[model samples]
Target: MTNTRSRGAASRGGWIRQYHHPRGDAPTLVCFPHAGGSASAYFALSAALSEGAEALIVQYPGRQDRLDEPALKDLGELADGVVAALAPWTGRPLTLFGHSMGSVVAYEVARRLERGPGPGPAGLVVSGNMAPSVQRDQGVHLMNDEELMTWMSDLAGTPPAVLADKELLATIAPALRADFTALETYRHPEGSSVECPISGYVGDHDPHVPHDGFLRWAEHTKAEFTVQVFEGGHFYIEDQVQDVARSILRDLSAFVSRRLARHPLA
Candidate 1:
């Protein structure tokens, strides 16, 4: 699609970073990054699934190439913006994978996309987040800089080097705070559900969301639902990228095949 003079390529370039685009007929996997995470985090997963799928990773504002732009402070605004940007890419089947804060963002995006006349996602994969119905009043976003760092230190996935470096921490602090505020302030609308199948990936040792919270994901999707428990903490997928990518590709390929079988012309 890049070699041709098409507006789709230009439109997609705004919020998406295409790390690997293979030459073949395959579905696209639109990946959402975690809080304080960038699109580059999925580079390895994109490379691993290069043959099976095209990975378009999201690059939110105030990070990496778009550091000058202000970060999005509202979950609904972020979802709406992403869904609008994705209008050009819904011509083919698409799947979504979101981790941590990305999970909620992905779900919101899916909800918005399904409401429109455009093509809905084939499936949704949510990781490291409890169901939307599970409410908590953790105001980590309102914490002072030192308090926020202390909380981050307690989390299993943060790198010690990044936490220890005052310069780097200052650079990323704004975006991080914005993301936390978004999540902290979010309240899921009652009676909301999506038509696409939903899958949950949970870390066995994650204290944020327990098994019951993960299982509650089944309540939000009318279609099929499944869950996988991996060994580790919040960022467990980082330790099992190959396995996670393989599983996602398998499920998405099966979904595409089913869709084709249902409507031979699709």
Candidate 2:
């Protein structure tokens, strides 16, 4: 629910990274990042959470410090690695938050945790992505590396500093393409959708995922359901982080209050 002084790392060849604010009293909030993104994506998010929670963000490999790592081409491979890597943190009433490609990954993580030998997540937050059940992917992942980078450039908001260099873009292209493939081609395991409280966040103007795609999440979580629109694009989670952070904090607060009322943390 919360972070203190915790630390996190993933296999250099793996597809996830992590950060921990180590503290036992705070609830643990596990975050998954967008495609071509690392845990650093949520660094500012910690400040937005309630004081009673710590943030543990997942760093999808293939970018930032793990740039040398071979990025994962399969969404399941990434999700499996994520669930396995964070095995130690699955205890207690955990909350999972995912944005963009992260939203799907978080949903998958929730599914994995449900199937795992542990308590399911107390709350679920999905942002900037369409529901996994209904996809309109045109097989952009099948695009050659050059086209993939162009697609990512047109779609994602990877820092300009990184995108400006041809050599750097060359290095990052495969992973970006892989991320697109992972999102585009991934199929939810047969009949596995979570029944936890789910809140959906979307960019008011994101073209990649539309309202209809987000509505499909209703078939998944049986707990309380919600959907909110923001004022940006596919990456609205970043473009309007403060507003998004406030919304997230609000939901996290409600979850905490309800949880403490039902099962006080001693």
Candidate 3:
């Protein structure tokens, strides 16, 4: 993929950084990051799995290597673009892993790919987000700027360095606001579900989504379903990512094993 991308002379060089062994008979596991995050955050996760798998995390624009580009709003615009970028690769069995705002992005990506002309995902790994149909009850757009800032402060998952740095904040705030605006406007209808295997995980003390909301994710898929609750707060998976990675590998093993039994490749 690098040579193909390089030959085309992409402006960002290798926009898709290879974080894991790119070669193997194993499956491909792609990760999407939370809002205001990038691929670098999961650079170490592939090692934590140690599974026979090749993993790559998508680098959203307006951050890190692609910082010069305009940022994606919420999951919809992001997924619309991602599905096109993924057209070349979705021929193989696919698995999506996403955290927090990333979960919504991953879900919508899967949804977009499933609709038009792409292969189905082997499975989906969603963490730290509420159910698909659940939107933020407290509207940040309705709130004043100060109230919104307070909400951001309470989340505390966004890095303090970015929040405090006026220079960087000037660049990041517009993207952040766009992300929230998209999320605030997002709404999944009742019984609207995905067609792939799905797993949902969250922390015990997460304030964003309740346990029942996580459980309802089971209704989204016809394939195997798993819901796990770890011990911590909303951002618990940040430090406990190894545990999340292990959980991903476990389900991915099953998905890949079944695929190999059928296709015997990819």
Candidate 4:
């Protein structure tokens, strides 16, 4: 699932991934990609949920058109920026879906939105990552260029062609390194938690994060918490993308329906 170029005003931005399906008056699904991933990573997800929701993919700095921009190395800072960027679209309810490093970003962003202003995310779907409160020393950012690439390959997120092409690898390494820095350095603030319901998804065989890690996400959310273990490794969504999408839409639709029932337009 890669990005296929589209032309439109919404598609042209350093922050928005243009491959979204704009559902008129539908609730929005905001997606954040994994470490070293671009918005295109969620292109398939966006298309899958197009009819039911407006899927918006976030484009983090140091990738694609944002390549020239300096990548933020702090998770909080990245979340802050995302909150501000999405301020204009707060009229409707939102659901956030993030994978791996993106899970951390989505968690933090949900925390901010819950405490600061506007409607909090209707729900949060965290995939391929442990709970933010679980502290682990991931020193991948500090590794040498060769070591970092090798580690990413082990995670199986990087394409073989991209790894084999020296020029391409060099071009993307800086962003990858910066992304790792953000993930490794993130620390959940003391007593911080989100009020929104949380759903955690993990691969049964994912070596990087186990079911225990995913289960711990329950502690960080004050609302309902559920975990779904799928079959595969770190990038399990590749095999169950539709299942993931359906689960997301089901949860989001239920929440939106309840919200509307309580506060229908006068």
In model 2, which regions exceed 4 Å deviation?
1-24, 50-52, 259-266
- Per-model TM-score on C-alpha atoms: 0.93, 0.86, 0.85, 0.92
* Per-candidate local distance difference test: 0.82, 0.74, 0.72, 0.82
Question: What tens-digit string does per-residue lDDT give for candidate 2 at 7-43?
Answer: 4343233433433343456666778887777777776
Winning model by TM-score: 1
lDDT of 1 by residue, 39-152 (tens): 888888889888888777888888887789999899898898888777667766578889988999999998987888766787899999998778755988888877887777
> Which pairs of residues clash in candidate 4, taking residues 3 or more apart in a chain or in different chains?
none
Per-residue lDDT of model 4, residues 85-119, tens digit only:
77666555678889999999999988888776576
lDDT of 3 by residue, 186-227 (tens): 787567778777888888888877777777778777676788
Lowest lDDT block of 10, candidate 1: 1-10
Worst 10 residues of 3 by lDDT: 6-15
Name the runs in model 4 displaced over 4 angstroms: 1-9, 261-266
* TM-score of candidate 2 to 2 decimals: 0.86
Residue 189 local lDDT, model 1: 94
Error of 4 at 124 (Å): 0.6
